[model samples]
Target chain A: MYKIESKEVSLYYGDHLALKNISLQMKANTVTALIGPSGCGKSTYLRLLNRMNDLIENVKIEGTVLIDNKDIYARGIKIDDLRKKVGMVFQKPNPFPKTIFENVAYGLRVNGISNKSYIEERVIRSLQNSALWEEVKDKLNKSAFELSGGQQQRLCIARALAIEPSIILMDEPASALDPISTAKIEELIYELKDKYTIVIVTHNMQQAARVSDRTAFFYIGELIEYNDTKEIFTNPQNQRTQNYITGRFG
Target chain B: MKKIFSRLLNHLITVLLYISGSITSLIVILIVFFLFSEGIGLFGKKPTEDGFIMAVNKSNTVNHLNAEQIKLLFDGEITNWSEFGGKNDSIILFRMDNITDYFTEEQIGENFENLPACISKVVDSIPGIVAFVGKHYIDKNFAGKELQVDKITVGDFMFGKLWFPTAHPVAVFGALPLLLGTFWVSIFAILFALPLGLATAIYIAEVAHPTVRNILKPVIELLAGIPSVVYGFFGLVVVVPFIQNAFNLPVGETAFAGSIILGIMALPTIITISEDAIRTTPRSMKEASLALGANHWQTIFRVILPYSSSGITAGAILGIGRAIGETMAVLMVTGNAAVIPHTLLAPVRTIPATIAAELGEASQGGLHYQSLFILGCVLFIITMIVNLAVEFISRRNRRVAS
Candidate 1:
C-alpha cells in the first residue's frame, strides 16, 4: 500500500489556479523529490499534503489527499492530528528564538508531552538523528539563533524530527545553505528516509537525482514526469523535463 | 558643469540639514536652560512675601524662624517660644495694624512719622513679641530686632507637603503631593492599560479577520486623536458619577476618576503600538508554531506574545509618558486638591495639572512663576527618562532581530 497518495488534487488561490490535477503515490521509507523552476507549484503541492496551504485566505482546494487511505480535507478532521503526523521544514532555517534544547523539544511539548526526561530523551535522539547532537550538546541552553545557517537548518530538522512524524516534507530546505551545508542536508535526508517517508522540493536537479528514490518534475501547474530518479535523469520522458534538467530553460 | 552643480546642491543640502539639526538641539537645550534658570530663582527668594519681616525684641533669644515656624507662631498655634528651643516665654503676635493700640494716632504725627519710634517702643516693651511688619518700617532708630527668615531650600520645595503657592502671608511650594499624584495616576493608568491593550492588540493583530481588523484599526487610532479634554469631559459626566455612586464617595473627582481618564487616554498609544509590534512578528515564526501542530491560540501565546514582548514594553512605557504629562483631563477629573495621595479614591493633583492651574494666576517671573517652571523641569525629567527607556528597549530589540 502507498504510504501517501494524492487523488486528482487542484487548488485555487481566489480566481487564480495555483495547482492543477496532480496525483502521486509514495511508498514507506522512500524519498520523493519534487523538482521544478520557480513558480512551478512544487512547493504549493508539498504544502497541500500537510494542509499548510489552508493558512492562506480565499484558498480553495479540490479532490483528496490520503494518508493511510484517509482523506485529510474531509469534514470533522482535526487539523492538529494531520499536522502532527506530517512535519514540514521550510526553505529558510526558521528556528524559534528559544534555546537549542527548547527548539527541539517544542513539538513534543506543544503536543502535550510533559514528561521532562522523556522530552529530554526525544530532544537528544532527534538531535543525534539529524547529526547535530555533538556540536550542540554543550550549548543546548543557548539560543537557536546563535547557530550558523547550516547548523540552524539542521536544528529545524531536529525540531521536525522530535515530533516523531511518520512523514516529513521539506520545501527547498537547502536552497538557502552553502554547498557544504547542502551536502550535509542531502546526506541527512538520505538517512531520514529509513524511518520517515520524505518529500523534498528542490531547485537543484543534481540534488534531486542524488537524494531521491523517485522524482516528480512539475512545470507551470502540472507534473510533467513522475518516475524513478535514475530513469528521469537519464531518459527523456518529456521535452520540458529535458530542458529544465539541462538548464536549457526554466 | 552638471557635476559641479550637483556637488554644490549637495553641499547646500548638507548645510541646511546641519543647521536644522543644530537649531532643534539648541532649542531643546535653551528651553531646558530657561526652565532651570527660572526654577532655580525660587531658591533665591524667601518663602515670605516681599518686604514682610518678622521682628522680635532685642532681648529675645529667638534669632531665626522658618516659614512654617513663623506661620505657626503667628497663627497662634505655637503658644510658647520654648517649643522652638528659645527661652521659655509666652508668644505674643504683633502686626502693623496693632500700632494704634500702643499709642494714640495724635501721639504719632498726623503723617505717622513718629510711628517707627512707637513701633520700636512696643517691641522693646514686649520681650516675647513676634511682630510681622514691613522691612522698610524699621529705621535706624528702631528698637526692635529683625528675626531672620531663611530663603526656601530645595529640600523644603521637594519634600514639603503643602502646595499653596498663592497663600497671602506665606506661600508654600511643596512638590511631594504633585509628584506622588502624577506617579499614582500613571501607575494605575498603565496597570489598567497594559493587559487590556495587549489583549485587544492580540485580537486585532493575530486573531481578527481582515475586515474586523480594518474596522478596528482606524477606530482605535481615532481614539488616540480625540483630545484629552473630551475624555476628561466624558469622565466628568459618566465615569466620575459612576465611580461616585459605586463607591459611595463624597466627591466623584478622585484619583480613581483621573486614573480612569488617563487609562482611557493612554489606551490608544498602548494598543496601536502593541498591535504594530505583534504584527511585526515574522509570519514565518507563526508558521513554524502552527506547523508544529499548535493551535492558533497556542501560537499566539507561545510565539507571537513572546516575540513582541520588548515592543509591548516600549509601548507601555510610552503610554506612561502620555499619562504622566497629561494635564487637562487629569486636572478636570482629579479634584485638584494638592495633597499627598494615600488612596486611589482620594482627590489628587499632578505636576502638570498644578502648572496648568496656576501658571496664569502666578505672576510671571515671580517666585510662583519660577516655581511652576521648576514643576515643568520635574515633568520634563520624568518624560525624558520614559523616552530614554523606550529608546533603549527598542534599540536592544533591533539588535536582537539583527
Candidate 2:
C-alpha cells in the first residue's frame, strides 16, 4: 500500500488556480524529488501534503490527500495530528530563537510529551540522525541563531525528526545555504529515506538525479512525468520531461 | 555648463538642508535653556524685583506665617489672629477690591489710580487687617509693614507632601504628591491598557479576518483622534459616577477615573505599534512554527510574541509616557486635590494637572510660575528616559534578530 497518495488534487489560491488535478503515489522509505522551474507550483504541491496551505487565506482545495490509507482532508481528522505525522523543513534555515537543545525539544514538548528523560533521549537521537549532534552537542544550551547556516538547516531537520514524523516534506531546504551545506543536506537526505518517506522540492536537476529514487517533473500547474530517477535522467519518457532534464527549457 | 549648474544646485540644497537642521536644533536648545534658567529658581532663593506680599499694620503680633496658615486665614478656616500665633484680634481681610470700600471714590480716583495710596492708608488705619497686594503697592513711606516671607526651598518643592501653590505669605510648591499621583494613575493606566492593547494587536495581526481588521483598525485610530477634553467629559459623566456608586465613595472624581480615561486614551498608540511589530515578524518564521505541527495559539505565544517582545515593551513604555504626561483629562477627572493619595479611590492631583490648573493664575516670573516650568522639565526628562529605553530595547531586539 502507498504510504502517501494524492488523487486528482486541485488547489486554488483565491481566483488564481495554483495546482491542477495532479495525482501521485509514494511508497514508504523512498525519496521522491519534485523538480521544476520557479513558479511551477512544486512548493505549493509539497505544502498541500501536510495541509500547510491551510495557513493561507482564501485557499480552496478539491479531491483527497491520503496518508496511510486515511484521507487527511476528511472530517474528524485533526490538523495538528496530521502535521505531527508529516513534518516540513522550509526553503530557508528558520530556527526558533531558542537554545539548540530547546529548538529540537520544542516538537516533543508541543505534542504534550511531558516525560523529560524521554524528551532528552529523543532530542539526542533526532540530532544524531540529522548528523548535527557532534558539532552542536558542546553548546546545546547556546542559541540556535549562533550556528552557521548549514548547521542551522541541520538543526531544523533535527527539529522535524524529533517529532518522529512518518513523512518529511522538504521545500528547497538547502537553497539558501552554501554549496558545502547543500551537499551535506543531500547526503543527509540519502540517509534519511531508510527511516522516513521524504519528498523534496528542488529546482536543481543534478541534485534530484543524485538523491531521489523517483523524480516527478512539474510544469505550470501539472505534473508532466514521474518515473525512476535513473530512467528520467538517462532515457526519454515524455518530451517535456526530457527537455527539462536536459536543460532544453524550463 | 549643465554639469556645473547641477553641481551648484546640489551644493545649494546641501547648504539649505544644513541650515534648516541647525535652526531646529538651535530652537530646541534655546527653549530648553529658557526653561531650565527660569525653572532653576524654584529650588533656591532667587531675588525678585516685585511679588505679591502679605502686609499688616505695624502693631500686629504675627512676625511671620507659613503658607498653610495664610491659606487657612484667607479661606475663612481661621478667623482670628490667635489661631495663627498673633494678637487676640479679629483677622480683618483686605483685598484690592476692598480699597474702594475703605476710601471715598473721589479720594481713590475714578480708575483706582490712587489704589496704592488707598491700600497703604487702609493697612495703616486697620490694626487687625492683613492685606494681600502687589509689593509695589506696599509703600515704604507708609506705616504698613511688609511681612517677611519665607522662600520655597528645592527640598520642599520636591519632597513636601502638600501642593498648595496659592497659599499666602508663601505659596507651597511641593511636587511630591503630584509626582506620586502622576505615577499612580499612570501605573493603573498601563495595567489596564497593556493586556487589552496587546491582545487586540495580536487579534488584528494574527487571528482577525481581513474585514474585521480593516474595520477595527480605523475605529481605534478614530478613538485616538477624539479630543482629550471629550474623553475627560466621558470620564466625568460615565466612569467617575460608576466608580462612586460601585465603591460607595462620596465623590466620583478619583485616581481610578483618571486612569480609566487615560488608559482609553493610550490604547490606540499601544495597539498600532504592537500590531506593526507583530506583523513585521517574518512570514517564514510563523510558517516554520505552524509547519512543526504547533497550533495557531502555540505559534503566537511561543514564537510571534517572543520575537516581537521588544516592540511590545516599547509600545507599553510609549503608552506609559502618554499616560504620565496627559493633563486635561486627568485634571477633569482626578478631583485635583493636592494631597498624597493613599488609594485609587482617593482624589489626587498630578504634576501636569497642577501646572495646567494654576499656570494661568501663577503670576509670570513668580516662584509658582517657575515651579510650574520645573514640573514641565520633570515631565520632559521622564519622557526622554522612556524614549531612550524604547530605543535601547529595539536596538537590542535588532541585534538578537540579526
Candidate 3:
C-alpha cells in the first residue's frame, strides 16, 4: 500500500507555473529520491506533501495530496497536524540557535508535550538514530553551533526525527556538506527508511541511486521517469532521464 | 587627448570629493570644539554675574553665601539668617530696585544723585540687611562689607542638587536634575517603544502579507520623519489631556507624556531596524521550524526572535539614541520643570529640552549659556555611547547570523 501519493498535482507561483501535473506514489518505509537540475520543480514537488509551498506568496496548488491515504489539501485539514506527520531536512545545516538538547526537544516543546523525561528520552533516541549521539552526548547542553558541519546536519536530522513523523523530506540535505559528511548522511538515510518513509531531492545522481529505493527524474516541471532506483539509473526508458543520469545534459 | 582629458577630469573629481569630505568633517569638529571649550569654561568662574557683588551690613557677620543660599535668602524661602549659621535675626533683603522702599524718593534726591549716601545709610542701619548691589552702586566709603562667593566648580556643577541658573547674585548650575530627567524619560520611552515596535516589526516581517507589509513598513517609518515638534504638539494637545484624565493628575504635561511622545518618535527607528533584522531569519531555519509542526507564532518566537536577537538589540539601542537626543517634543510636554523627577507622572525637564527652552533667554558667555552648552556636551556623549553600542550590537548580530 502507498504511504504517500500525489494525484495530478500542479503548482503555480503567481503567473508562472512551477510544477506540472505529476503523479507519484511511495510505499511505506521506503526511500524515494527526486533527481533534477536547478529550477526543475523537484523541490517544489517535495514541498507540496507537507504544504510547505503555502508559505510562499501567491502560490496556487491544485489537485490532491494523500499521506496515510488522507487528502491533506481538503477543507478542515489542520496544518499543524499535517506538518507534525511530515518532517523536512533542508540543504543547509540550519539548526535553531539553541543547545543540541533543546534543538532536538524543540519539536516536543512546540507540540505541547512538556514531560521532561519523555522529552529527554525522545531527544536521546533521535540523536542516536541520526548517528550524532556519541559525538555530542557529553555536550548536549552546548550550542548546536559548536558542532562541525557534518554533525550539525545530523543534528538537524535528529531534530526532525524528534517530531516522530512517519514521512521525512530531504531537500538536498547533503548538498552543503563535505564528502565524508555526504557519505554519513547517505548512510543515515539508508537507516531511516526502516521506520520512516523518505523523499529526497538531489542534484547528485549517484547519491540518489545509492540512498533511494525508488527514483523520480524531473525536468522543467514534469516528471520524466519514475521507477526502481536501479532501473532509473541503469536502464532509464526516457531520453531526458538517460541524458541526466549519464551526464549527457542536465 | 581624450584619455588625458578623462584623467584630468578624474583628478579634479577626486580633489573635489576630498575637499567636500574634509569640509564636512571640519565643520562638525569646529562645532564640537566650540561646545566643549565653552561648556568647560563654566567651571573655575564664579556663578555670579560679572561686576556684581553682595554687601552685608558691617555688623552682620555673614562672611560668604553660595548661589543656593543667596537664592533662598532673596526668595524669602529662608526667613532667618541663622539658617546659614549667622546670628538669629530675621533677614532684611535690599536691592537696587528697592531703594524707594528703604527711603523716600525726595530724601534720596532728584536724579538719584544722593543714592549712594542713602544706600550707605540703609546698609549701616539695617543690621540683618543683605544687599545685592552692583559695583557701580557702592561708593568709596561704603559701610557694608563686600563679599565674593566661591567660584563654581565642576563637582558642584555636576552633582549639585539645585538647577537655578538664572537665580540672582549667583546662579546654581547643577546638572543632576537635567541628567536624571533625560535618563528617566528615555528609559520609559524605550519601555514604551521596544515591545510595541518589536511586535509591529514581527507583524511586518512574519505575519503581514506583502501588500500590507509594504504599506505598513513605510508608513511607520514616516512617523520618524515627522518633526519632533509636531510630536510635542501632539503630546501637549492630546496625550497630555488623555493621561491627565486617566490618572487624574492635576496636570498632564508630565514626564509620562514626554515619554509617550518620545516613544512614538522612537518607534520608526525600532520598527524599521527590527523589521529588517527580523526579516533576516534564514528561510531555511523558518522552513525547518514549520516542518517540525511549529505554528507560525511558534516559528517566530522560537526561531526568528532568537536568531535575530542581536539585531533587535541594535534596533532598541538606536531607538534609545533617538529618545535621548530628542528635544522639542519632550520640551513642549514635560512641563519644563528643573527638579529631580521622582516619578513618571510628575513634571520634568530633559537635557535637550532645558537647552532649547533656555538658550534663547540665556545671555551669551554667561553661566546659563555655558551650562546649556555643557548640557549639549552631555547629550553628545550619551548619543555617542548609544551609537557605539549599536555598532557593537550590529557587529555581534552579523557574526551570529552567519
Best by DockQ: 3
Deviation in Å, model 2, residue A123 alpha carbon: 1.6
lDDT of 1 at B313: 96
- For residue B246, give model 3's deviation from the true position in Å: 4.2
True contacts kept of 3: 0.91
lDDT of 3 by residue, B227-246 (tens): 88888788988999999999
Span of ten consecutive residues with least summed lDDT in model 3 chain B: B65-74
Q: For candidate 2, write residues B292-325 as lDDT tens digits.
A: 7899998999889998999999999999999998
TM-score head-to-head 2 vs 3, winner: 3
Q: Residue B303 of candidate 3: its Cα lDDT?
A: 90
Candidate 1 structure, TM-score to reference: 0.91
Q: Which parts of model 3 have CA positions greater than 4 angstroms off?
A: B51-66, B73-148, B244-250
lDDT of 1: 0.91
Query: What's the DockQ of model 1?
Result: 0.70
Over 4 Å off in model 2, which ranges? Answer: B1-15, B46-156
Q: List the residue pairs that clash in candidate 1.
A: none
What are the models' TM-scores?
A: 0.91, 0.84, 0.89
